[model samples]
Target: MMIEAAAKMAQWLRLEDGFTLIAHTSPDGDTIGSSLAMFYILTCMGKRVQVVCEHIVPYLYSFLPYAEAFNTPDTAEKSYKNAIAIDCADKNRMGKAVGIYNASMLTGSIDHHKTNTAYGDYVLHDENASATGELVFHLWQHLGVAVEKSKTALDIACSLFTAISTDTGNFSYCNATPGSFRAAAALVEYGIDIAEINRLVYRTLPIGKTRLIGYVLSSMRLYNDARIGAAILLWEDFLRFGAIPEDVEGIIDYIRDVDSIEIAMILRQTQKGDFKVSMRSKRYADVSAIAGRFGGGGHLRAAGCTMQGQPEAILEQLLQVSTDALGQ
Candidate 1:
C-alpha cells in the first residue's frame, strides 16, 4: 500500500521541476531521515529538491546524506511546485516552515502518527508504521524507485535505521512489525555501522545534558506509591545546567522503567513560557488520549502536549489525568 502511494507521489512529483521537503522543528532522526531520504531520491532523479526545517540540523544528525542541502523557510526559494511535510502530524509542529506549506501549489504529508490532521492534499499516514522512514522506504518502492543497495549509500540506510531503531525503542516497542524488521534487515545489508549510530544517539551525552538529567532525577515525584514518576524542567533548570530544550529529550524513558512505575511524564518550559508535556506508559495507560485532552496527541504509550502556566501546574494536571485514566 505504501509502495503504491509513494510511486503515485513520485509520479506526481516527477511531473514537476522544483519542490521542497519540509520537516518539523527540533527534528528527530525520523524527521531528518524521512525528509533527507526523499530529497536524495528526488535529487537522484534529476529533480531540484531542497529539504527545509525550522532549525538547522543537530550536530548528531549532521552526518546524514545531504545535510547541507536543507534550507530554512526564510532562505527557501519562492513558489515551489509542491511541499512535502515528513514525520509531522500537525502544521504547527512545522514551526517557521509552516508558511511555506501554506503557500505551496500543493502540499503533501507523509507520517506515521495516529493524531495526524490529514492536512495536505496528499495524506499518507500509517499509524502502525514504526517511523516515517519505513513509510518512505515503502513509498520508494511504490514510486518504482528501487533502492540501490551499496556500501557507499549506506548513509541513507543508516538514516532509516536510526529512525526505526529510535522510534521502536530498538525494536522492542509494539510498533515493531515484520515489515519494520524487513526494512531494518535491508538497511543492515548496506553494511552501515549500527553500533556507532547507537552510541552517538544514546550514549554520547554532553556534561550539561548529564547535569540536566541529574536535576530531573533529583526533582522526580511519584503519584501513586512510586507507580507514576513525574519530572518537571522549567526554563530555570535549563539555565542552571547550561542545557537546552533538546537535552531533556530522553529523560522520561528512564522514569518509565522504574520497577513499580506504569507511567511517566516530563514537563519542559517552551519559549512562550508555556509548558510542553511529554508522557510515556509502560503498558495500557493510553497516554495519547491523556495528551489529547490538553491539545497534544501521539501514540497510546507515548504522547505529549503543550500547556499554559507553570510546569508544576501542568505536571499536576497531567498526573491527575493520567492517574484518573489509569484507574479507569
Candidate 2:
C-alpha cells in the first residue's frame, strides 16, 4: 500500500533486495544531501544500495560525507532490483542516470519540487517540504531512529543537515517552513559542525569561483525597466578565469540579491555549445513556467533550461517569456 506520506512510501523498498539511489545530474546540495542520507539509512537497514549521478560532485560539496562515493553511469551496475531518485523533479533530470534507473525492476522517487512531473512508482512528493531532507528525516523516524540516538549516527545527521541547509538557503529561503526548521534543529543536535558546514557551503569559495562571480557582477545587465537582471557567461569567460562548471554554482544568487531586480538570470554556455538558462524570481512571476516553455521545470521562484541558439536570441526569448508571465 502506498501511503501518501514519504516515510510510508519509503517502506515499499524491500530490504532483501539491492537497489540504486539516484541524484539528479548537476546535483545541488539538496540532491546530494538527501541521496547520501538515504544511502546511510538504507545501508544501516542492511539493504544493499549504491548512489549514482551523471556528473562529478562539485568541489564545494566534496567536503560532505559520502560525497566521494557517487558513481557515474559508466561505472554503475547494469541493473538493480529497485531504483529511487532522490530530489529529482522528473526523470529527465536524472540525465544519463535515468537509463540505469529505468532498467530496475521497481522504481520510485522522493522529491519536494512543486514542478515535479510525478514519475515513478510509489513516488513521494511534498512541495511544502523545505528540502527533500525534511521528508528524509521523517523516514529516519519511521525506521524507529530516536532523536536522542540521532547524534550517534553522525554521517546520517550531517548528510541530512547539509541537504536541508542548502535547499533552505541556510534557513533563510522562504521555502523554510516550521517543519523544515524543526528537522534542521533536530539534525544539528546529532553533533554536526553547524558553523563549519555553513562557512564551507556559503561563505567559502575557490579563487576561480570568486573571479567568476566578479566577472558576472561587472557584466550584469538589467531589463524590464531594471526589474530583470542577468549575468551572461560564454565558454570563453570560463576559460579566461580558469573556471570549471562547478565554479558557476550560486552565481545567480548574487544577481538575484539586487534590490531593484525582481528576476535574476544566468546564461551559461554549456559544453555542447548551447546556452543553459537559469532564472530566479524575488517577489512574483513563475520562472518555472518560463523555463518549462523551453522544456525545463523547477520551482516557481527558481528554474532553468538549455537552449541551442545565438546567445542574444535565447535571452530575448526568455525575456519575452518572463514578460508574458509577469503580465499575467
Give the alpha carbon lDDT tens digit for every residue of 1-328 in model 1: 3555666676777787787899889988899988888887776677888899989888878777677778988999876788889999999989989898888888899999989898988878888898999988777656655447753257667778888887887888788999899999978887888888888876788988999888878889887878789987878888888898888878888899888888988888876788888999987788999999999999998999888986666777787888787874
Best by TM-score: 1
Cα deviation of 74, candidate 2, in Å: 3.2
How accurate locally, in lDDT, is each candidate?
0.83, 0.85
Q: In candidate 1, what residue range of length 10 has the lowest lDDT sum?
A: 144-153
Q: Give the Cα-based TM-score of candidate 1 against the true structure.
A: 0.76
Residue 161 in candidate 1, Cα distance off native in Å: 1.9
Clashing residue pairs found in predicted model 2:
none
Model 2 over residues 124-214: C-alpha lDDT tens digits?
A: 7788888888888887777764435544378888888989998988898789888988887887777788989989988987777899999
- As a whole number from 0 to 100, the lDDT of residue 125 in candidate 2 is 77
Poorly placed runs, candidate 1 (over 4 Å): 2-4, 117-121, 144-152, 215-240, 262-328
